[model samples]
Target chain A: MSQELIDAITDMREEDAVAITKKLLDGGASPVAVLDACREAMGIIGMRFETGESFMPELILAGEILAQISAVVKPRMQQGGEDKKLGKIVLGTVQGDIHDIAKDIVGFMLDINGFEVTDLGVDVAPEKFVETVKSTGAKIVGLSGFLTLAFDPMKHTVEALKAAGLTDVKVMIGGGQIDENIRQYTGADAYGKDAMAAVAIAKSWA
Target chain B: MFIRPDNWNQMSPLERRQARLDSWQNAPTPPFVSPEAEKNYRERISRVRKIYDMAPHDRPVADLFMGANEYIVRRKGFVGKDVIYNHAALREPTLEFHREFQPDVSVGAMPYPGKPWDMLDFKTYIWGGQKLPDNLAIQAVEGEYMLASEYKEFAADPTAFWMKKYLPRAYGALGPMAMLPDFPRISESVDTIDLLVPFGLPPFQEMLKKMMEAGNELMRILGEVGQTGAMVVSEGFPGMGFNIVKTPFDYLGDTLRGTKGILMDMYRHPKDLLAATEAYVPVLVNSIVGASDRTNAPCAMYVLHKGADGFMSQAQFEKFYWPTWKQVMLALYEEGITCYLFIEGSYNTRLEYLAEMPEKSLVCHFDKSDMKRVKELLSDKFIIAGNVAASLMSTGTTDQVRAACAELVELFDGKSYIMTHGCYFENTTDDKIRAFIDSVRK
Candidate 1:
C-alpha cells in the first residue's frame, strides 16, 4: 500500500488517483500513507531548488507536476473527511487592479496546508466577495488589492461584508499594497507581506 | 601578446627594458579636450541646469558591501544577454522567431552538465506596445531585481498595446505634486525585522518563520544531494534587488500621446496626458525601496537603462526622476543599505550632466561608459559592477567566457561586482547555460 501511494506521487498520474481510491475502499491503504508520499515528493523537489542545484524554470514545472499529482490524490487522502471543519475561505483580488501573482502564491500555499479557498480571479468586485462569503457560509474572507487606488474598493468590500451581516467573520488582507500599517488602515483582521506569511495567518485564524 | 609560459616571472634586464618600452609605447593617454570645447560643454551643462535645477543629494547614509563574489569572473556566468535578446527578437512585431531555435522557458542546473539537479520556474511575457525604445530593457532590469533573474527576453513581460497605455493626469505641468494617498511609503523598519529574523520569531509572529524553518531543513538535505555534480553557483544574493521595469514612461507603455499627439489632444480635450508622474514617482520608488530593503541584503542594485548617464539627459532626469531616486536612496540608506544602478548603454552624450553626481550618490553600473575613462573618473566614488559584454558568452567559446570573466574579475579586482551579463539571457540555450557555469565556476 505504501509503495502504491509513492508511485502515485511520483507519476502524478490521474490513474494513480483512481487506484489510491480503490485501495482506500478495499481497506488496503491509509490516508496517512498517501499524504506522506505527496508531501515527501514536494519536499524532494523543494530541496533540490534551495541548493542552487535548480532555478525557477524547473521549480515552476515541478510545482505544476506536484499540483497535478496532488489534485488526483487529495480527495482520497483526505479520506472521506477533512481535519477541522476550519470554516470556509472566499478570496479574490480587489477591483480596478488585476495583479494576482502574489495572491495566487498565497492561494497555493493555503491550499497546500489546508484551506478551502474560493479564489475569484483578478479585478474582482467587492459585492461579489461579500455575496460569495454569505452564500457559502464561509467565516473567513481574504481580499487582495495591488494598487493604492484599489484600496478604496478593498475597504468597500469589508464594509459590504459587515453590511451583509458577516461582521464576525475574519477578514485578511495582503498583496503589495497591504502591510501591517495598511492592514490597520484598511481595517483587516490579519495581513501578510507575501504568500508564505499569508498561509501561516490562515492556519492561525480562528 | 606572446608570453613565456614556463618562466612567466623570469625576466632578464634587456627583456624587462623591452617590456617597459613597449608598455610606454601603447600606454593610453588621457583624451585631450581643448579649452574652448571644455568651456562649451560646461556652458551646456550650466544652461541645462538653469532650465532644470540639479536635484539636491543630501549626505545620503551609505553602506559598503564586500563582494559575495564566488564565481571566478574569469570563470563563466549565465549568458543572459544572448538568450533574452534572441527571445525578444522572436516576439518582435515584424520579426520572426529565429527558426532553428525557439524561446526556452525552462532552465535547470545539473550535478554535471548532463544531469538535472532540478528545474525551476521562470515565467516571461512581452509587453505588447512599448512607449520608448528602452522600455523593454528597463523591464528586463526590474525582473532581475524582483524575481532575481534577467531571463526575460527583450520586450517580454509588459508588451503590446499595454506599452502604449497613457493615463489621464489630474493636471498639466504642475511641478511635483504631493504623494498619492493610500499608497505605501517605504519604511526603514524592514531592516530591523530582517536582522531580528535569526533570533527566531514566535512561530506566530510571521509566516516566514515557518518557511525559513522549513527552508533550513531543506537546505540540510540539499547539502547532501549537492555533493555530486554541485550547483551552478554555491551562494545566492539573499538581499539582492532585481529591477523588473524601467521608469514611468515605460510604465505607461504606448499610453503617452507623442509631443505631436499630445499637442493635438491638448486642443481636443486637454486633461489627457498632463503631469501624472508626481504621484506615481513616490509610489513606485517606495515599492522599489521597500521590496529591496525588505530583503535585508545591503548591497541592492536597481536595473535602469538610460545608459550610464540616464534615459533623459541629466537635467531632465534630475527634473523628473532624480528626486524620486533620491527619496528611494535615502530611505534605503537609512536602513544601512547601499545601492547599485545598472546604468546601461552610452551616456557619452550627456556625461557632463552625470559627472557631478554627489560623492558615491549611488554606484554606477557601467555599460557604455568609456571604461578606462569611467574607471579613472568614477572609480573612487561609485561601486562599479560590470562592463563584460554578453557576446563573449554567446559567440566566444567557454574559454572565451572564462577569459572575459577573468579579465573582468582581474580588472575590477578588490572591488564589488555583481558579476552578470551585459543584458539578460531570456533565450540562452541549455548548452550555453551549462558551459557558461562550468567555465566560470573555476
Candidate 2:
C-alpha cells in the first residue's frame, strides 16, 4: 500500500493519490506512514528533476498532490503523530525581487525533506529576515532573488543576520542569475542552482 | 500598398525579402547634426547590414542594451518613478549615454507611459512609479488571466477571447468589455445595431471615456519620446530594435496563463494548449510584420521567456514551445524581417534546436548560456551576440569586466559575432559599461 501511494503521487495521478490517501487512513494506516510515502514520492520526483527525466510540471503536480494528501492526513495526525523535523530554516525572495515560484519550490522541497521552513514570501527586506530568524530561531536561511538588484539586498541580509549576532546561521542563495561569484559577493555560505541543491545544502547544515 | 512593391505577390519569398532589405538599406536618412555625423551613420549602417548578411565587415559591432532609468538614477539621482511619470525626463539621460558611450547602436529607451497605465488601472504589470517608487524596472504580476477551462474558447477565436474575456481580466477599467457581443456573429444590419446598444449604457460609456483619455495621454507621451528618438538618431546612433515580438508559447505563458498555470496545463490540457499556441502564430507574425513595415526597420526583437532549459524538459520544449515559435520566425523571415532573440536564460541544452533556424534570419543574443558551447554549436549557422554576465558587470571590478570582454572578443576572433552584455545594464555602473565598449571597440 505504501508503494502504491508513492507510485500514484510520483506518476501525477492527482485524484488517485488523494483517493489512496483516504483509503489508507480509513484502512488503519498511520498518518506518519502516509506522510512518509509522500516524502518518498517527492524524493523520486526531485531525483527525476535533477536527472532531467522530469521537469517543472512534474514537480509542480507532485507538490499539488502532496498538498492534497497532507490536507487529508493532517486531521488524523493531530491526535498523536508528532514527527520530528530535521531542522528549522527561514526562506524568502530578497528585496526588490517579487518572484516567488522558485522560492516556493525550495520551500516545498525543504518541507518534504524534513525541515521546518518559515517562508517569509517575496520582496523580503533584510530587517525582516533578522526579525524572522530572531522570532523563529531558525539556523538556516535561504535568500532567493531573480534579478541583479537583489544582490545588494542579499549582501545586506547576510550582514543583518550577522549584525543581529546570528553569526552561526547558514545562508544559502539561489535564483535565476545567482552563481558562485554572486555567492561570494553576497557573503552567503553557499549557492544552490536549484531546489534539490537547496535540500542537499540544508541537509548538510542539519 | 505603400511599402510593398507592385510585383510583391509575383515575387518569390527570397526576392520579396531582398526587396524589403533594399528598402531598409535605402531608407531616407534622418537629419544629421553635421557631415561627420552623417558619415558615421552611413558607416555604422553598412557595418550592421554586412553583419546581418554574414559578410566581412570593417570591424566587429558593439551594442548596449540599457534603459534611461540607469542613467537617471546614477547621474541625476532620480528614482524610476521620476522618469516613468515624466516622459521628457528621459531625454537628457538618453542622449548623454549615447553621446558618452558611442555604442554601435542607440540605447533602447522605450517609454513606459505611466499616466495611461494609471488611468486604465492596469492589472497585468506593476510599473516602476505605481507601486515601488524605487523599483528599477517594471515588474509583471503573473496570474491566470485565462483559466484552464478557457483554452478551447481561446483557441476557437483569440480575438473574441481577447475582447470578451482577456481584456476584462487584464485591465480594471475594461471590465465592461466582457459585455461585448461576439463580433463574428454580428454580420447583418440588425445585429450591428444590437452591438451599438451596449455602447449606450453608462458603464460602457464610462469605459470608452477612460480609453479615450488613456489614448490621449499615450499620444502625448509618444510625442515626447519621438523627439528624443529623433535627437538620438540626429547624433548618428542608428536604432536596431524598432519593434518587438513574443514567442507564441511565451505569449500564452506570460499574458494569458501565468507560468505556473501554463506549466500545469502541459499535463492537464496539452492538446488545448498546443492548439492555442498554434492559433497565436499567425497573429504574432501579422503583428510583427505590420510593425516592421510601419517602423521601416527590418529587425524585430524577441525577449524569449519560459522556453529556457530549466523551464521544461527538451521533449516538452520540442513539443510545445519550439514548433509554434519557429513557425512565427519562419513567417517573419518570409516577410524579410530579422528576429533578434534574447535567449534570457541558459539554453545550453537547446542549442541544437536553435541551430536549425534559417541562416541569416536570427541574431541569438544569449544571457547565461555557455558561450564556448554556443560558439561550437551555433557560430556557423547564425549571427550570435552577447553574454557578458550582468552580475560581473554590476559587481565585478572594471578590470574583471575588461577581462570578460577580451575573452569573448578573442573567442569569436571578431567574426560573425556582436559584442554585448548578456542582458540590459540596469544595475551596471558607468565605468564598467565604458570599459566593456572600450575593450571591444579597441
Candidate 3:
C-alpha cells in the first residue's frame, strides 16, 4: 500500500495520489508511512527537475500534491506522537530586492521537509531578519537576491544578524547567477544553487 | 518566410554566417518611396554615412549611446515628483540639460499620449504597493500574466484571447474587460464606435480620459521641443534611430507567460510554443518592415530580456529561443537593416548562437557577460558595445571609473566598440559619470 501511494505521487497522478492518501488515512494506515511516501516522491520530483526532465510547473504541481497529502497526514502524525519537527528556518529576500519566487520556493521545500519556515517576504530589511531570528530562535536563515545590487543588503542582513548576538545562526544566500564568490562577498555561511540545496543546508544546520 | 536547415546545429558557425550573407545578397531591394520622402531618406542616410566615415578614433563618445532614464531623471531634478504625467514639462529642462551635456545623440522621449499600458494607473495596477510606480527600465518585474495551461488558447487566437482572457487577469483596471461578451460577428454596416460605447462604462471613461490627457501633454511637449532639431543637428548631435521588433519567444515569456511559465513550457509544450512562435513570424515581419520604411533608419534595436544564462539550459535555448530570433534577425537583415541587440543579462554561453549572424550585421550590446571572453568570440564578427560596470560609476572613485573605461577603450582598439554601462546605472553622482564619459572621449 505504501509503495502504491509512493508510485502514484512519483508518476504525478494527482487524483490517484489524493485518493490513495485519503484511503490510507481513513483505513487507519500509519500517517508516518504516508508522509515517508510523499517525501520519497518529492525527492524524485526534485531530482527530475534538477536533471531537466521536469521543469517549474511539474515542481509546483508536485508541491501542491504534497501540500494536500501533508494536510491529511500531519494531523494524524501529531495524534500518533510522530511529529518530530525537523527544525525552524527563517527565509527572506534581502532589502533592496523585491524578487520573492526563489525565497518562496525555498520556504515551501523546507516546510514540506519537516522544517518550520517563517517566510519574511521580499525587500525585508536587516532589522527584520534579526527580529525574526530573535523571536523564532531559528538556527537557519536564507537570504535571497536576484539582482547583483542586492549583494550589499544581503551582506548587511548577515552582519546585522551576527551583531544582534545571533552568531550561531547559519546564513545561506541563493538566487540568479550566484556562485561561491557571491557567497563569500555576502559573508554568508553557505550558498545553494537551488531550493533542494537550500533544504540540505538548513537540515544540516538545524 | 524563414526555412531552417535540417541540421541547423550541425552546421558550422561559419557556414551559418555564409548562408545568411548569401540570402541577404540575393534578397529583393526595397520599393521606392515618395520623391519628398526619398529626399529626406537620402539626407538622413547622408548624416549616418558621415558619422560612419569618420575615423573610429575621432567619433565622439556621446554619439555612441544615450544616457539611461534614471540618470536623466535624477540629474534633471525631477527625481521625486510625478515625472511620468508631467513629461511635457520636461521639454525646457531637457533642452537645457542637453545643452550642458551636449550629448551626440538625443535620448528620444517615450511616445507621447502613449498607449493604455503606459498610463501610471495601469502601471500601478500591474505592480502594486508603490509609493510611486517603479522604474521598470531598471528593475525587472517577473509577471506570470499568462499561465502554462492557457497555451492552447494563446496559440489558437492570441489577439482574442489576450483581449478577453489574459488582460483581465493581468491587470486590475482591465477587470471589466472580462465582462465583454464574445462577438459572434455581425454586419459591419453598424457604427463600431457606438458598439464600443457600452464597453466604455464607469472606470473605462476615466481611463480613456487619462489616455487622452496623456496624449495631449505629449503633443505639447513635442511642440515645445520641435524647434530643437536644427540646434541638435548643428551642434553635431545626430538623432538616435531605433526601431523595436520584439522576438516572439520574449513576447510570450516576458509579457505573457512569465519566466517560470515559459521555461516550463519548453519541457511541457515545446510543440505548441513552436507553433505559436511560427504564427508570430509574419506578424513581426510586417510590423517591423513597415516601421523600417517609416523610420527609414538602417538600424533596429532589440532588447533580449530572456535567453540569458540560468534562464534556460543551452539545449532549451537552441530548441525554443534561437530559431525564431534568428529568423527575425535574418528577415530584418534581408531588408537592409542592422540589428542592435541589447543583451540584458549574462549571455556568455549564448554568444556562439549569436555569432551565426553575418559579420558587421549585429551590434551586440552586452550587460553582464565577461568582457574579455565576449571580445575574443565576437570582435571579429560583430560590433562589440558595452559594458562599463555601473558600480564604478555609482559608487567607485573617479580613478576607478577612469581605469575601467580606459581599459575597455584600449581593449577594443578604439574601433567598433561603444563605451557604455553594462545596464542602466541605479544612481550615480555627476562627477563620477563625467569622469567615465571623459575617459571614453579619447
Q: Which candidate is the best by lDDT?
A: 2
- Top TM-score prediction, candidate number: 2
lDDT of 1 by residue, B210-282 (tens): 3355456455444543321121111100112233334443332222332222222222222322233333455
DockQ score of the complex predicted as candidate 1: 0.01
Candidate 1 Cα outliers beyond 4 Å, as residue runs: A1-32, A40-62, A70-85, B1-442
Docking class of 2: medium
**Candidate 3 fraction of reference contacts recovered:** 0.08
> What's the residue-level lDDT of A191 in candidate 3?
93
Candidate 2 residue-wise lDDT at A184:
86
Ordered list by lDDT, greatest first? 2, 3, 1
Q: Write the per-residue lDDT of candidate 1 for residues A140-164, one digit (tens) a residue.
A: 8888865444556777888888888
Least well predicted 10-residue stretch by lDDT in candidate 2 chain A: A74-83
Q: Count the backbone clashes (under 3 Å) in each candidate.
A: 61, 0, 1
lDDT scores in order: 0.43, 0.83, 0.67
User: Which should have the higher DockQ, number 2 or number 3?
Assistant: 2
lDDT of model 3 at position B119: 46
Model 3 residue A58 distance off true place after TM-score fit, in angstroms: 6.9
Write candidate 2's Cα lDDT for B180-233 as tens digits.
Answer: 877678888789777788899999999999999999999999999888888878
Task: Summing lDDT over every window of 10 consecutive residues in candidate 1 chain B, give the lowest-scoring window.
Answer: B113-122
